[model samples]
Target: MVRVTGNEASMVLVMGVTGSGKSRFVNLLRGGSVEEGDGLMSVTQECQIVRVKIGSELAYVVDTPGFDDTTRSDADIFEEITTFLATQYASGLALKGITFLHRITDVRMQGSTLSTMTMFKELCGDHALKSVVLLTTFWDKLSDKSIGARRQQELRQEFWLDMTAKGSQVRRFDGSRDMAEALVMRLVDRPPVVLQIQRDIMQQGKRLEDTGVGRKIATRLDRSLEEKDKELEDLEKQISKASKRRSSRDLKQLEERLGRKLTERERIYASRQKLKASLGPEINAKVEKQQKSSPIMDKIQFFASILGMTVSVTTNIVLPLLGVAF
Candidate 1:
């Protein structure tokens, strides 16, 4: 979840072992095309930083080489992550947090994966408190029970319990279209003020996010305003005619009453318009800003962008290269 705004920027790292579906998850989150690969096999030999937009914010999702690569030693992997973080921070990018992505299909958590997580935590220092553990690739296989329950049980027996006891947030995510909404809700701690307005509208049997009532109200209001204006114009004409005739004072009084009613209606319409103008964007901005600080949101945004870009790059460039060579 990379949200970039003119106000501030945050960077997140998506990390996992080879074949843990890091690239797939990234592409899914990003709404991008999927690439063909079995882990870290790619044209990209080193770590890469991909930029993505989330609402009014800019987010950078850094994808590092897989931690459990057979060719790369544990020390080398650790150094690679450390170097990336150091370079980013030195370049004045704010280091917000890391998402430790694990494949739900992968029943075994290797030692190298654990080591990678530990190294990230140590490198981040106090900021590690902001870290989120995202269990990715969850929808790979369906089961009556939770996938890899035995492995999850083992993790709970070992790491999960400890992390929970220490107040770390852990969430399970299956990369899908609804991922953004899910991530946004999880990350945004404060309710949007516009939600109150929506609630009010809902009580009147309407929903703000729903197109039906809002559109109906808008149409009706426009017609009503036009009709009222016409009525006011007619009343003025009647008043003028009555004054010229010098026969009926009652018609003049009726015209005055209609004039007052029209003024009141216009005032109410103006007030509603003012309320809509004031609350809509203000609430949206608040909701979006709060989302940027969310670990889950950050993870979703980063992975989504990376996955899309990776797939596009692979399809357009890598696949063509292979075709040319073969």
Candidate 2:
């Protein structure tokens, strides 16, 4: 187990799209057995915190679910994350920095990738961007290093320009425990910062939907609902024509399309509902859930016992089972 001697340890948050190597990165750091997601599916559905010994200080490294999660809505993911951040901030635990992972092998940034980046920016805001690191992963998977280098430059110049200009860094995460620790140590000395979303909810007394990241997600959902509605309309027209013509094959295809569209619409509506619901009750319920089964409580209580701090389940942040020491 990592030893702590200070009033608080530095905390770092790792964020990225699903399959961007978040769990793998945390596992590398602590020699922990956090389950890594296959490149297509996400395994770290909730925030997973691990204790790591960086030089002499211990930092709590948190792994978060990405925006385009395979099984959960973005709204749900955002709410869960908000619970973690709000708890930590209210407990007086500011983060030293945040690391955003990305796959170096992706040829270009997709719409989903751009949207995730936008959310990250909004969550951090301008001032906190200085503490952000854009860590690119999967370099070893690239066949031609030159192509990857060019893509990296494109990210800094185009897609990630705003963040880079605002003091966010772009670095490559070579697949090694040493590199991961190095990334964490880079921000250990910088004064801890309260993220924009944390301030919005905790200090400014803003509702979840009123925050910057919240507004971005809401806008995206609105556009997606509109697009899906249009697609449903188009499918309805095609189905109508197919029915009038009595073409069995086309009618079957159109009907199947309509069914898929309806299912998607239902999911979109559900996500919207989650966004509209109150956050206080959800967070309180999550706290209750963690009280019964979360290993994070064990770790936090352990910290409290050693550090002489007052740690309680009410502010218990979600932590997955993690091995101790690096």
Candidate 3:
């Protein structure tokens, strides 16, 4: 419907592990109050766009749900983020850069963290690395500057070196508004390039399931299905044993958990199966229909034109009685 180009507001995507200070970082940038969560809870569960000023210009910063959110599955987060991004692109929102936050205090990169990063890479693709900012956050929590620096160096050498080698810039966030503003200012001037995912869907006419990310997610779903099947079998055996022992309380809890897991398993299978190998003419026709029906700018311009006519009417007729008060 909406043409996605560089004419709209500039958008910067902030993402990474949960509790890595992503919301706090965005709060400083936008100078707006976004809840900074505590403990194991992730603050941002949906992708939101906030407008922040960079000197004389205004830009948008997209605060995203964290990758390791305990409350949601990867599929849930992925679906939300993907839907938001696709909608934005469709509406002509031009993306400037993506800032990935990592906690400097974490001594080891946990598996969930790594899985999140892998998912991030798959979403962006190799070509989009040039627009990535590998930002290390929560630096103020570190007791020693050298420790942080050394850890940063180790990351460049061990994990992020490949990405940096490809054009991603690694920077340390001092958890200051100035630093956040500086990062936004630097990236907003760059030419907007369509992300690989955007290109795959829009230009190549590929469905979500055909992209590299869709394939990766499908693989995970398959493995998860296998695990769920095994768990289901084990739960059945346990339920049988509990039935013989007459433990009603334990049986009830186990049955409830079994029902939940079964529902989740079915959802995963359905999600995987619905992803088509390719987007055909039906999708194309729908897009075209949306484009025709959604003439938002034209409607606005019509109202604006009416306003212009009202001004003319005021000048010629109403002023005749007022007699040049100004």
Q: In model 2, which runs have C-alpha deviations exceeding 4 angstroms?
A: 1-7, 223-264, 277-326
What overall lDDT goes with each candidate model? 0.47, 0.76, 0.70
The C-alpha stretches of model 1 lying farther than 4 A from their native spots are 1-7, 31-36, 39-44, 147-150, 180-326
lDDT of 3 by residue, 1-326 (tens): 44433224577888989998888877876544466786548877777656665655556777789767877766667656665555445545568888999999989888988888887887887888888989998888877989999999998899888788878899888887767767776777676756777776666777767777777777888898999999999999999999999999999999998999899889888767755534334444544555676545432122222223111100001111121111
Summarize candidate 2's per-residue lDDT along 142-206 as a digit string, tens digits.
88999989999988999888888888888877887767777777677689898888777767767
The residue-by-residue lDDT of candidate 1 on 1-326, one tens digit each, is: 23443445455556666766656655644544334376444322356554555454445556666655666433344434433443343223455544566666665766756765554444433324444544545555647435566666666567666554544455555555355223432332222111112332322332232322233334545666677777777878877787788857767696768879788667646533532322233333444454555434343333333223231222110111111110
Residue 221 Cα positional deviation in candidate 1, in Å, after optimal superposition:
75
Among all windows of 10 consecutive residues in model 1, the one with the lowest summed lDDT is 317-326
Ranking by TM-score: 3, 2, 1
Model 1: lDDT equals 0.47
Report the Cα RMSD per candidate: 25.0, 7.6, 11.0
**Least accurate stretch of 10 residues (summed lDDT) in model 2?**
311-320
